[model samples]
Target: MINVDNLSYSFPQKDLYNKVSFTLEEGQHAAFIGASGNGKSTLIDIIMDPERYMFDGKLEIDPNCKIGYVSQFSQLDKTKEITVFEYIAEEFIKLQNEIANICTQMETSSDIETLLEKYQEALDAFDAIDGDDFESNINKKLNLANLNKHKDRMISELSGGEFKLIQVIKEMLNNPDLMIMDEPDVFLDFENLNSLKNLINSHKKTMLVITHNRYLLNHCFNKIIHLENMEIQEFDGRYIDYNFSLLQTKIELQELAIADDEEIARNEIRIEKLRERATYNAEASNGRALKARVKIQERLEARRIKAPFVDIKQPNINLANNNEIEETIALKVEDFSVAFDEVLLENVNFEIKSTDKVALIGINGVGKTTLLREIFKNNNDCIKINNDIEVAYLSQMQDEILNESNTILQEFYDAGFETYREIRRYLSNYGFGEDRIEQKIESLSGGEKNILQLAKVSASKANMLLLDEPTSHLDTYSQIALEKAIQNYNGAILMISHDYHFIVNCMDYVLMIEDKTIRKVSMKKFRKMIYAKHFDKDYLEIEQKKKSVETQIALALMDTDFERAKILSQELEALIKSL
Candidate 1:
């Protein structure tokens, strides 16, 4: 439980956030969403420990509550003395001990202050480290963060995904009354993401999350607190509800302001006309009009209408080109294996063709990204790439591409643009406006960087596109914009994405990566795995005999075997199940 009033923070002259106020109730789930680096993390640091950061504000906090945080960056000291397992075990003991002490105090009926002093000592230590049920806690956390499968290994050897998984596990064991996590979903796989949702469901505590995972945000959080332009706004309900409500509020405010402006203008004109009339009739009429106008304007201005909400909608870059590869292969991988210190994929063979939109699905440590890099030779992998091919790759992390000295405009120019104005215009089409173009590349939000990367590649003449989770952390509008662009593209595409909507819309093929091997499947076949086979199949002739056989049965069951149809359906299902 906490409250903040008139909180403001500035960097020398620029105020990243100024005068933000909000409150969080005990056991409530809340989310903070805004453009990246718009003081979201800075605000979180302040909330977690105000004393640590220099700021002017009156923050009312439950002094008794111990705060636990899982940061997005997941800064860790790998060279620490203890082994990773030993460290985890010690943390678990500390948390369990703290919980035990709390119970001990309650049993002895100690005074709140004495209990507080003892509890705080244990809690501080526990919160600083990971807590009780070390094994289960780690597993649950790793599962949620999608990192637990890598636990037996040394911390130093783990990948970025592994580190992120540990951070989530640490939070689970600590069991703080309040949990603050930033970007917790970046590395989560399907199963772990579900585990996290279950944990959130079971936990009876306050949760303050900063994430861009739309499904989790919509499903888990009830309150949405969005920050932008150095301000914060509270809205009831989930992401979709918040978005709709915000849009409605904006439309209403715009209408009200327009009406008020017209009224004020009319009043001024009436007053001027009355001033020109020197006669008694003019003076009386004008005086009445002026008085009424002043009263109306004062009432309107006094009627408190909070500033209307506005959403940051990204621009749609419609990428289209002449259809080049209609019957040729786009990418082929045979006996593909890659690793730094360990092998990721082994003896993999797959070929992607024109008009075959594909998705490479895999878990966190499975090297979905590494394979992409290997395809472009960004890393080492045993594979053969076709010489006569054009390709563009979108990386999972853009931090490596960042240059501190470059501005957004300059980056575009460096990427091979003619002039400042040309790059500025191109960026504007991808959501960077005039005000944003002059901003340094380092100052741009994560979403902005992603869009910029997409634009840069979209402008290239490459007909083959290899994307690695391109839609990760992007907002709904931006995601839709990207989907539209890909749909409009005439070139071949072999993409890797987890966003269900985007994958379904843009993919005609799918490659499920499991056990370091790629099991390629036509998207049409994958759809059948989920469908119930209701009324009948499409009129087109079926290529696969298995599907055709089932279609005939569904058609035959229209009358004679309606009752026995369900039984026959089970048999058909059984046949497919064998696959």
Candidate 2:
């Protein structure tokens, strides 16, 4: 449905795309993935409105095609006081209002030509969205997303994740020829994220999504459009398959690179000997041999192997803890109840021991963020923190911790850095280049802002961390690095996250909020819950067996029992095949 050929675009700061070509056919769901600040959103904007850009490219879009876009930063005005249905139907309402206004004007004004043209345009737009059935379509979308009960609720009453899903419903109901969503799954809770995955899988039209969400990436897309180093590649397969192929290719390339390095080393030694001999002998043949050796060395250097799509820069995320609290409880909450218009959580109790890595999880708008903030403040009667434990907090909203107007250098300065050179050296570990250090925080991408937050948190040297949705805008590479950091941290962590992969990777246990109280769940039960909800019932059992067999194999190998290890290995392979 969309074809981009030899598209070359650049920003004032750097080149983004160079001769990039890709195609999205009808019914193809494509994931537009890349590192942060790589112009994924900018490309989407260009595709939506190519006339606004002056670039060398051929962008062919169907003439009759309609597009529905959900921007990453699009937000509803909470104070607008409109119902969810009214908000979703805003476009239909506008077209109807415009048609009515034009008809009224045409009846009195002498400018009949202008009024008629306006009326025709409004009518066309209205019909394009099937204005007659707009309400029904909205209801259908809400039902599909399992949000029909919230149709009459005020838009301001919705949580961030709820509102994000509402935006998806609105766009899906518009029945566009293609839907383009930018990071629509960024901060969604687990349930809402599942709803979104279902919506994507069930949609019968074309889609182009830009997200770093591994869950959605693995389950939703049939095509992958990867942008790296100003080049784009299209893969026509599942993300899991694509990842395996990339891994295989990377291994092959690394082997070739090692061989190339060895050959170059040997050639260098040979060239050194040839030159040494040529320096002593005045023979023409000796000089020619040295020249030939030098030429061969140059060719080897020029032909050195380099791995493709495997060198993307990853941030060095370090969450430091110097004071390791061993025996004391890091934090405690008892009989905590928070209320706004109504009681959200009541009589909640939880505690984190020193060096414990725990996840605080609940549905969106279940007061998870509020609870974390209260713990951070530590002024309430229901909260108690150990005197020896120093705390650092990472808020989900970047504005809460970062000054948008300040440059990276200035921000680090405010964070207690003594010198600009020191700040530059520190930020470099988080993938901030020298040229980007002077740029204001507002200009950085969402992922970059999160990286900056992590950097600041790391510098705090606190023994306890209260993190709220810490992985919200981090790209996949940064997310993985953050996972490793969390795993290696000696400090206690009470993190609120909806990322299943991250939670399983880094957290030792879960503190789940249910029915206005806290319930501690083991990782095994958490895995069971996830598997039952998102996968087959047998999946968890099979995974457990696989883990057991692998452990057995490892023990057998350590004991020098080769026969036992081979038997356990075969059993592990069988379990994996079942999965």
Candidate 3:
């Protein structure tokens, strides 16, 4: 129930929205997607608080609408020591306590008028959200998200993904008319990501989500609002169908562009001949012909195809090792146990050989990050590392490796860059512009920070890497590029990740945490385990087949094998329709 018309906004460094317009109607689940640093979050801010900005636009929000917003980077104050139930009911509890205090004051106060007015205000506010049933509502939401067991737990005890879902449940209980989430799926584990998908699917009210998560985009939204090239394209369909249509359009446009290129080449030759005749003959007729030919060439050039949406730039991530290590144990853990208040993992043992790429995976809050950090420190008696192997570590928390107070240039300098020019040149491959090189690292977006981590890690040239959730905040294009880099890295890797697609694409084997112990499994076994837990066994099988067919179709089309391409396209269509 919001409409934005003719909106144009920009910052001092770059332009964002240029006469962009879109609408969010009731019962619509819209995915707001775009490249990183393209003003998706800024637009959300403008919608939430328009008075803070001075821009030329007509934003018409329904006067009676209630909005709920979840920011991209939100953290709980663990020092407060509040339970999940109490945290979700904090607003209602405040209003209830205020009403009781006002009533107690009315018992013996001379300023009865003031007390009565304040009491009425508190009562009305409490009743607006049905405070009488707030506890029941909170319980129901927790049950719906399958988080009933965590209702009585302390907020500090929950994992990042669990806390995020708790925030969503808290917002839902507010009975908002519209809910907006900015990258709610950024760092969630697979199970938690699926929980979010189910929550979005079951939501009755309108929602607008800004995320680069392909899983959520495929499974949750009915509408797609894509911002590209400083404009908007709204599609009233599933993202899968939209992507298919985009692929077909790109192929057709490429064919037309090929023909146009050929025609332009011939036109250029004709113009050259006419110019030569005009110079030799020195006649008015020849000169006029040359002028006409030149105009035609200009017209053809102007009409050449330009596919802005089809051609998106990706970061260059090359994690190539500078030196090779002998075939030896890169890392080994023996009889290790980690605990804070209670044991989470016990008697765990694992080893990685030089040049091996292995994934250390488990559900959220299962000590994966903890164990990885301990290995990086190499101080524990139970852990062993080879002396010849150089190590690089990438933490999911950017602040652990990046200095927030330092500029990008300074950070790179600390990362061992020799000069400012060299730092700028290296950072450009990761999509950082020269204008942002002098800016503080704290000012960059989450996605930008993650890309900077990749750049820094690649520069280390270490023979061994310990990466934790390396793809958390990256966009889809950057994710693909990182996957390629990981696949080609000439080093040993022990990565902690919950991104199924990324893990399957990059790692060679799995070292999974199960029942408080570490166990290694083959890639084939890991695939089966995932499919059995998360989907039908045939789900990934069919998807792989469809991808193979799509590739074949593209190659056939490129080779001008129209009949073969048509056959493959039909097969692919059938597979998609079955899905």
Candidate 4:
């Protein structure tokens, strides 16, 4: 168990927390949630390394308990060459070394009995901690993450998402009493996210996860810890329940404040009347009455209710409608094949209708981002776009578009807005206040950078948007706001995201990239198919067979083999109808 009391942290510029307190009991799974830059990470840092930071707080943790941490950013040194298996088995390797050392001591020591006792003790400790089954357990988790094939691959060779999974697996292998994960869902795809959720649910340890993924928060955590407005608020249920309770509390506070204001006004009026009467009389008795009335008014003022809790204002994103264009297809890809030493995708074909909102999804290290970038390559014969359409692309790496040296105000102006009022109005829609406008871009958090890029994209007035991981670092509220904006957008959107909720809310179609092919399906049908695949093995096999046939058909069409394409088309039709 860990107890935190009166935790306060400050930087040279701002005070993040003030007298915040919370507790994490043994075996409790809790979620930490708040807007970006609200000190959620700072609180974790203080807990993990109290001496590194200067803060006033009382953190009481069980001395025997071990902590395992997975940071949002990669902590591994990419330059070092370490295989996935070696990394995950590091803890077990250390235990083995200790046991071997005990054996060596037994062979050399004069006090042979003492050495033998120590050796037995070490062996027992190893067995008690499941060290004997370490390899099997690591393999099982790696298989669950669909990374068994890459067990021998160097960590440096893996993609960011893959490496993140490895880090999570490594932490789990430690079997720590307390697991602290920060934004673990940022890099996970849908399948891996499910695996991670299942792991968290089954683990018999205390957990404190900081994430903006609503599904994970609602399903995996039994408690919610909200860090907002320099305070930490604890709730006893899931995220949805906590959110509802918070809204109700805000409403109640508002009503009480309104009543208090009215009563204070009435008291002040009565006090003024008494003062006027006393002045006219100018007598000792009247003076005494005025004093008494003044005291009563003071008491009433002292009893006035405090105002309601108001969240920081987030930006209001209002994307401009696309200009009218005659082209029905905003983008079309045919016979698209891409390779980087090995084939990532082949014979991929899809079309984005002018009014369509399409999502691109696939497993980690697949060709989702590759396919999106291929369109921008412009030299590829496979991709074609309407001549009059303007395209705006938000890459997964947000820094590609942001200028680190520029201030927020400067970046907004650079996006084509002329006046300060215009820029401020646009920034305010995204939750940026006057104080944040002058801040340098480099100092902004990841979520803030995402918002800035979104604001720029909205200002572009482009008819076609190619967004890669657009919702990655955004808070729940910001994500919902972006979804609403996308819903109202008249332009075409071809986005690559792992956020199932955002995809369902904003996208009309899904372009799933798998097995070096892209298959298009409606959002509703995709959801149903994934649900079926999860619960029924027979259904999953059928879907896999259908996908295989579809891929064959796409390949046949690309080769202009009309006869083969016709036969495969009939087979695909029959398969779908049967399902």
Report, for every candidate in turn, its global Cα lDDT versus the true structure: 0.67, 0.84, 0.85, 0.79
Identify the leading candidate in terms of TM-score.
Answer: 3
Where does candidate 4 stray beyond 4 Å?
10-15, 62-65, 75-82, 94-130, 143-162, 301-303, 310-312, 321-324, 403-425, 534-579
Model 1, range 360-422, lDDT digits (tens) per residue? Answer: 876666778778777876343445445555777777676645453688777777778898788
The global Cα lDDT (0 to 1) of model 3 is 0.85
Clashing pairs in 4: 314-431, 315-429, 315-430, 315-431, 316-429, 316-430
Off by over 4 Å in 1: 8-18, 35-39, 48-57, 62-66, 75-84, 90-150, 156-162, 228-230, 235-285, 304-307, 310-312, 318-327, 339-342, 378-388, 525-579
Estimate the TM-score of every prediction: 0.74, 0.84, 0.88, 0.81
In model 1, which range of ten residues has the least summed lDDT?
534-543
Question: Considering TM-score, which of the candidate structures 2 and 3 is the better prediction for this target?
Answer: 3
**TM-score head-to-head 1 vs 4, winner:** 4
Q: State residue 50's C-alpha deviation in candidate 2, in Å.
A: 5.1
Cα lDDT tens digits for candidate 2, 133-192: 898888888888888989998998887788889998889877899999999997788778
Q: 1-579 in candidate 4: lDDT tens per residue?
A: 889999888765467899999999988899999888777887888888877988887888887778899887654467868888998888788879988998888777899888778778878767755899999999988888778999998776676677787888888777888999988888678677777787788777899999987567757998899988888999877775676455445545655776788888887888788889887889898888878878887887787777654643356887775575764998989999988647889998888888889999888888787788878666788899878778888877767789979999999788888999988877887877776788888767678788888988888889888998988878756776788899998888999888766687789899988799999988778778667654344444554566456546545544545567567766766665565
In each prediction, how many residue pairs overlap at the backbone (N, C-alpha, C within less than 3 A)?
A: 4, 0, 0, 6
- Cα lDDT of model 4 overall? 0.79
- The CA lDDT at 558 in model 1 is 33
RMSD to the true structure for each prediction, in A, is: 11.7, 5.6, 3.6, 12.3
On lDDT, the stronger of 1 and 2 is 2
Between the candidate structures 3 and 4, which one is better when assessed by TM-score?
Answer: 3
Residue 428 miss distance in model 2 (angstroms): 2.6
Residue pairs with colliding backbones in model 1 are: 91-130, 92-131, 142-148, 143-192
